[model samples]
Target: MKIKLEESTFGLLLASLLLIFGGVFSSAVQYDYTAVIDCLADPLKPQYNGGIIINPEINDGVKGWTTHGGVKIEQRSSISGNKYMVAHNRKQPYASVSHKVLLEKDKLYTFSAWIQVAGKNTTVTALFKTGDGFEKVGAVEAQVGCWSMFKGGISVASSTPAELYFESNDTSVDIWVDSVSLQPFTNEEWRSHQEQSIQKVRKSNMRLQVVDQNGRPIPNANITIQQNRLRFPLGASINQNIVRNTAYQNWFTQRFTVTTFENEMKWYTTENTQGREDYSAADSMLAFTSQHRISVRGHNIFWDDPQYQPWWVKNLSPQSLGPATDKRLNSVVSRYRGRVIAWDVNNENLHFNFYESKLGGGITNKFFQRTRQLDRRAMLFMNDYNTIEDGRDSTSSPSKYIAKLRQLQASLGANSVIGIGLEGHFHTVNIAYVRSALDTLAATRMPIWITELDVQAGPSQAAYFEQILREVHAHPGIQGIVIWGPWSQNGQCYQMCLVDPSFRNLAPGNVLDKLIHEWGGATAQATTNDNGYIDVSLFHGDYEAKFVPQGGRVDEVSPQGKSLSFAVDHNSSGQVIKFVSHV
Candidate 1:
């Protein structure tokens, strides 16, 4: 009764199934599972086929590869008969194998390679020596025994001849590389991939069929679907101004279903005078958000930056600092335990380590453990900036982030629930780098959210904001996004503002509104077919459907309109709902 089929055979069978079920379930959505299977089956294999690199597989004995920076290049084979290129006896960091290739102007090129090291683990960077200078395309931590895949890309502004090379800072280790690939894609092709990913990940098909009591088809019924809530958490940060300003409340509540206070819940804000505490502003904001059914992400429990600490706590001894931090954690976390969805436990821990430097190295782990105990339902996040926004920041790179996460996991045990919160504050958007960074972090399989997203103020600010939003939303790894821009009456914002003083939308605000509309914020209408069935693809959310009998007056059929509530989610692919008609 059981059968095992080869990949090609399974593909043929999948095609047959599609043909067989395509008409019988015309209203249901069909997904091609071949790609998923292929990805999971052989992840170490190279994905690019049309790359420009010559002798990428090393089968021709390193015909196209040459020594760079006076190193030795040779083609070697493994016991399994797999050929690879090796660069040995390195004197400098950039001493490795190099390949020259002509790159096109205004094109995006994605690079990948399988690498390993002869001795200890080291970070290997893939670089391109272009007409301008040396450009780092990608990097990976190469290990001793196993092969690791390095993925990254670069966008060129002008056509130039470039020499692609690999580099390792450790001169004692020999680098082994295989399956080198450099594939280029046009802007249109890249956008098309994003759209396709969005359609597959964020949407589901729903089929509505109307029938009489006797199971007879009631044709020509008008169906109206209005989305009530979007499941994807697209929200913004808010300041205390929202508590009393009616215009501010309206503007915020209309678009966002989630929010985070700008500063109300921080340790410095709540306990400025050490023993004295205040939660009135935070309580009021929470009340407003609770009334509107908006979920909140706790802005922070503590800040690692020395400048952001409370004035009174700065001069405290280690003994006093420990107790004071415990009190702060208990007061805030216990006060709003079940109300918030996530907590930025130690904000900017990677960039600054005020508590760590004063208390000890174990302070952050202790805080995370205690926060989990206090608010068991909330996700504890390690939030930091520049991990994805600026790849040049080695202090908070994706690899470093993962290393910190692993250290915490080792200390907290395997079952600890931690979230990755990247504060996406950017100036000029780098689309390829962003995607590659996300891909690298997503390998950990941890829940990732863009905690504080904003672009610097400029003429291209709106465009960059739109690019970031689209790219993050299209990525399946990103679970949520919260914009950092908060509105003020004087038009002063952290970096970018969605609206001006008069409550009119700014350019960035307009971009957000347009995207919200495209992602199922607008009401839609459709008519049933001859079989009383209507199929539609919708973003995952709560929806209200109204059925109007054909040829009947709008008010004549039920004044309230024959309506029903339904939900569309990832598991709603073949979901069928039947509405009974009295007419």
Candidate 2:
């Protein structure tokens, strides 16, 4: 019956202590249950790096791993990547850089590096394809190297795991690839790899074929090829989205990359204004051409005429205006220095009042000197209108241009000048004109190009297109044709759009498939059985080609005809031999 203070106090303290401990234990249990786990393995755990002759592995401590095909690994010292302990270098052209990583196709991943120029022309790349559909993805740049980093990335194809690649040109190039690895994302670890791959490929920059109503790679759509390699994957449908945006890039535009302008660089654009000397407009236009992957001709840098020369310069003595003209030449040529495939240093110097007569002879010489000074790489061309137009023998005019070209060469050395361009801007280009021009320019025994030939397609569109293609293809001296005004913006003068204003196929575009089919070979691969056939690698396009019972060497066409290009699904399977004769 006696109340004990100790007992009461002890019971209260015990009860309170138990409640506190229970609350703490409950929180610990809840925290453990809700915590996120990381099941993804770290990719960098593997060993890779080596050197060639001196030491085999990438570096002294670098390790190597294997995948498909034969691979060689070695360590190559580089000017850059000096901070990095060592560099992993490989020279296999077929598979320059390949990695097996945990990649869900559509996920956003970045593969970047500091690549230096090891050769005259070099490219650093990463390649991968989707499904049996074979949709490939990679990156390429023209003439880049060590001064800075060359970077590229693309979304991967959905579904099938691809042989991811990074390759470069055969021309000896030392690419210091550092910080090379796959990127991270939230959904890649948790969600579907297919969706992630789809996003990767969808956001990628490489061109792909379009889909049909059935969501298959469009069969006959034209896409560009690069470095003698097929643009798209062998069996994958090209992402139509990729092509529409990339139609203008140089190599990625189509299998058949061509010149859009022939000889439109003229007095109008160059000397449009009077005394106000200007070249920013021309530079912008040239940059645009380069960006769109279009090549250009110089037109005529110095044409003999009252209009070509500024009104103020005409009255001034040639000697007085020399500095300003030199400045003009330097600016014009330098702005488009390497970008221009070729340039007409002085147009029609022999026929018209050239800078030689007014300024002095060897003015063409000065022009070439200045051009080479800025860009020793650009091909200096001497172009002239009418010398090769209308099927007439350009015996007099072309002969004169050639004579001057020869004289220039004689004065300098044989290699001083690279090529002689013949401007063939014609109202109606005839076979005779082509022959006459070639015949005259051939006398010079120099490399020649048909600078501008706008073959009128009013009534004779089909005939003219066939004739031009055949003639140009046959000419040996002629390097290539630059068709001026090929597009609407360019062809405003000649209405040269292959697809007319109404978006209809123009004369040239209509029969172009046939020409390509005849010349383009069908390098068929894979053998068809119950489920078609299989081949390791096949180039893209319609494979608009024909092969004999015994197909010639791999990637070779029959003597009967040229192999045509074809479109294949990046994800299609089997030994598939398409028997279509014409594209």
Candidate 3:
């Protein structure tokens, strides 16, 4: 059952249980996922550009990977000279070392790599960071090292379709990369990523700088910053020791021009304060996602719980939560009608006992009516966990969760219910349960997503990622999988991060790569002017405006790329056409 964020029952239980839970899973790699792609190229040779880790002196006696018209193609160690040397691919192309991976929506990923550029711009650098559907990183920098053996690594964050690279701000620089890898980082790990290394703590010349929103600098901001993570598990991270790095490296080929809600829209925090009806958080999420041209899910327009509704709701004298709730729903919805694309009309009704028991049998209908009345254009979904096979029996049960959902669909009339959210927040949850859940949910003819998934504790976690992803990807009805908390830093609940605090990738993060950006078949085109303005019609996927080129595609791009997922939206009347330009 969905619990409120402030619910002490679970919070106290979890807090009390945290010791046991933490101990039980301590050595289990907290992260069990694996790495998928491997950059086996070597640098120092004229042909290999910056995509390798070793420094091999090629003198017509050896061969290696090289670049042409910007695309790095794998060639047997043949011609080793400046002629066949490094030319940045205006297009970022990559040679495949592909392995199977599973990516869940909502889960965060932490990507780390050692990248260095000495002279010319490192365009189409290594596939520094990429994935099927992720778009942005706040900041990264080109670090310096004495040599290949001492190359420096930069830590960054990414979602699915992860990316990593040495984006050269200077056009006349050469960058070398080695030991590039990515893994998932959960909430707690996020806290730990910023911890001070024992060595750094002992440094004498280390002077810390404090800054503010405009970057004018602030002396006291450090105090507030430190307070944020203070209660976290790691001591220094709580000190707000994370660097306020400027000129952060932008690795992806695309930017999430649009914005999104917190953690793919959870039911708990959305309206926990009740009559207060504060949507600042959600509005901020949508607006950010939208400004970045990122599409966002409306999460759930209707979840069945008193906490979701204001206390004034349950106290409705005549039983109605008042036109305020309805008006609020309609107001918030209508504001984002076209921009916000999807909605979970109802969330986990089958998992809990709700107001429907007291209200008439109209729980589902009321939700649909309000949503349709406001955002008539949004896609509506009936989201639930346990949609896969039953965890208890491992059999695709038509009688339990799916059955109730189907009954709700029939009762609510199928037209209003557009999809299913098979949230795989498994505690003891298994792939069999997820698979079965999707099979039955798909029978309703609605597209599905593995909404809020968490591959709970132990060595089996990585395998859990692979199994669930393989099964989910194999299913035609599953459109997306939003894993709960990709990083440990933001996890309000537990420690399910794919990578731990040390900026390491878990095996699961590796497997999920295939699921994220590797959906394949992508092409991009855009134009820029002296004002650095550009206009273009990108496809229904992620894209970045880069001067660098990948393999087999267009050009006039930036050394750094940005992406936004573009999907079709058909209105009953006609298609909603949009024209956008980015700076």
**Among all candidates shown, the one with the greatest TM-score:** 1
Q: How do the residues 59-109 of candidate 3 rate in per-residue lDDT, one tens digit apiece?
A: 332143243235342212323322212223334223221212233353333
TM-scores, all models, native as reference: 0.89, 0.44, 0.44
Once fitted onto the true fold, the runs of candidate 2 whose alpha carbons sit more than 4 angstroms away are 1-280, 310-316, 390-398, 427-433, 436-440, 489-491, 495-497, 521-583
| Candidate 2: residue 161 Cα off by (Å) | 72
Candidate 2 per-residue C-alpha lDDT over 187-291 given as tens digits, one digit per residue, 9 for 90 to 100: 212112222222222112122223333443334332222223322211100111222333423222443443423323443445555445555455555555556
Off by over 4 Å in 1: 1-43, 549-556
Worst 10 residues of 3 by lDDT: 230-239
Error of 3 at 546 (Å): 13
Overall local distance difference test of candidate 2? 0.44
**List of clashing residue pairs for candidate 1:** none
TM-score: the better of candidates 1 and 3? 1
Candidate 1 lDDT over 1-583, as tens digits, reads 2223334454444333333232232212211111111111112555465288888888889888898999998998887778888999999999999999998986677777788889898888888999998777767767787777756778777999999999888999999988887877666445545555666678876788888768887777887889998989999999888999999999998899999999899988888786889999999999999999999999899999999999988899998999999999999999999999999999999999999998999999999888888888998899999887876666787777887887787777886768999999999776777777787777777899999999999999999999899989988788999999657779998899889987899999999999999888999988888999988878889998877666764456663437778888889887888877666
The deviation in Å at residue 216 for candidate 2 is 32
